[model samples]
Target chain A: MEKCKKNRKLIWLTIYNELSSEQKSQLEIHLQACSDCQSDYEEALRLRRALDEKIQVAPTAAQLEASRAELHQRLLLLSQPRLQKSWFDKVWQIVSLDFAPSWRFATAVALLTFGVLIGNFYSRKAATEYNFYQQQISELLESNISNIESVTYDPVTRQVAIELNTLNDFTIQGNIEKPEIQQLLAHSIVVRYQNLSIRKKIPESD
Target chain B: MGNEEELLIRRAQRGNLKAFEDLVKRYDEKIMRLIFNMVSDAEDTRDIYQEVFLKAYQSITNFRFASEFYTWLYRIAVNTCINFRKRKTIVQHDSLDSYLDGNNDNWQILNTSEIRNPEEQLINKELSEQIQKSIDRLPARQKSVFVLKHYHGYKLSEIAVIMNCSEGTVKNYMFRAVQKLKISLQGYQQL
Candidate 1:
């Protein structure tokens, strides 16, 4: 004889099925020897019969229709588009800075990286250009002031030259030829003209 | 109802509204009855039954022919009933007096001939009712297993899928449910 282990659960399930002829014989042999399994099987059939009676019950047809209608309406309501958001959705959107679909996430990351790179490059170029312009302006101003201080011999030329420097480099150009120097030059020219007048006595060549 | 249910599920999954409506017409009663058995409240059972079907409708798109349509529907019904019961704190208990009175009265009407009194019928009904009470007293999971298995004729594997449990777990539940019911129906043969 094969070792027929009595699996209690297998016996319980077998009670409900159309047992094979051999399985029926086996069950009979087992039941004849095992009172516990037999009683369990009998109780299961009794409980099933009771449940079947309960299932035979019917409700009013109108109530059934009403339930269907009500549920249909409820489902429709749920299906309708309404502004529903998760409570934390906005907060997450603000704080996350990384929420997107897979493709969109990748695109957004690429765009952000591109933006940062462009911004950094432009800012560095602008700073370098600004420093260069400051150096050029300072050099121009220094050269204009030095030119004014060094001008001396021709007074009329000096005025015209100073005027040109002031017009071109007004920021640092200033008056450097002194008034006393102008007056001395004017007086020396006058004395020379007077000595020539005394030597020739009849001065007019009218 | 069975064939029509199968056909409607097939056609509904294919996007046939008329077929789905016909299916609803066919099963509307049984669906309500099953929910009523689980929940016991008229309003709640009715609502749950409708919601179960609506869910079935919406989820028909995801449904595959892995199991019988009614099996899938039964899963929806059972889950909806369980959720409804949990949310509303509703529990079903055995109606002992109603069971006894209803059975005795029906028998009295059927057995018009006093000479042929079928006393065994009454005893059988009582025995079955006591067993039902024992099933009722079992924990919710065990009771559902007992109902799905013994009443609905669901296979263990089907029950496992519907209940979302391992087959071994379903077997364990059925085993314990049967053991408790057998003890509760003690002296049933003498009844």
Candidate 2:
């Protein structure tokens, strides 16, 4: 039974004619003595015959010729230097390069740092120009002090009040729409209004 | 390798189109048949057939004569078919009857006068289809192994190289494929 078991496993290879002469002789001896092994061998032979004689499907000559012709045409095209690499090949080429991961990380970091530096420089430059314009507006407002009676600013409303001493002492009160007025108010808020009492005094005077 | 094949490979490597075409003509039939057996679809087989040679031609410059040209070509064929199978959902269809009938030459060769009776012909056709279905049901690796070993008559070692696996693994796949096929075709054994 053990022999039969082993022979049964080799029976398929035997039927397929894959065994060496020694193995074939051994299997033949086993088949002759064991009916079970004989039946298995016969069964395997039947299967092989079925596959070879009946189930064998081959490409027709016409099909083969057509395939060959098509391949020939394609090979002709490929014989020329490829004008374009496939996107996948391009990506693979890039990825297969000798660049190290550390190099990639460094490049990304450098770009990020460069971007941040650029952004910071522009922001600081804009702030400096703003401060310069505010200083000029405050100087201009100081020069026009002869035409003004009193200057009142409301921090909450962001409005400014100018009590003109011309004609009748009327007050001109509106939100600071002019850059000059905004600068003058911004100057007073930043410099002179360091103390809350002084800051509150301007709103109370109105 | 034969001196002729070596000369052909050398010429093909040097951008000799005629040498390349000769090489393709020599192997295209076997390659097409292998692809057809692997995929069991004529259209897909043709596409893979074209792709194999095209890829070989495009990358011929990289061929360093490390192995036989056939082995290298089979590697490309096997890999291409495996990838094609992986990328597409296999829709099993009963087109064997059409395939057999469409190729009357194969039909005549397979069905001689002794088995020409209508009933026996019908039974044989059905049995063949059952066998195909069994083969189709095998997993990809097992199917490739079985097709290469049984259909294409490749050696176990050759299958190993084509599949890029160990000989033991190829044998295991072949065993499993045979077992599955045996079980599947058990009903038609008496015929």
Q: Using TM-score, give the best candidate's number.
A: 2
- C-alpha DockQ of every model: 0.17, 0.30
- Tens digits of per-residue lDDT for model 2, A97-184: 4247767766667668989999999999979876765675555545433344556767788788756433444454556776766655
RMSD of each: 15.4, 13.9
**Fnat: each model in turn:** 0.22, 0.36
lDDT of 2 at B77: 89
* Candidate 1, CAPRI quality class derived from DockQ: incorrect
Positional deviation of A85 in candidate 2, in angstroms?
14
lDDT of 1 by residue, A54-146 (tens): 323345555666676776676566556688778698656644654556656776677689899999999999788656645644554444321
Error of 1 at A3 (Å): 8.2
With candidate 1 superimposed using the best TM-score fit, by how many Å does residue B125's alpha carbon deviate from the native?
Answer: 9.1
Superposed model 1: Cα runs more than 4 Å off:
A1-11, A33-56, A75-206, B1-17, B90-133, B164-168, B187-191
Question: Which pairs, if any, clash in model 1?
Answer: none
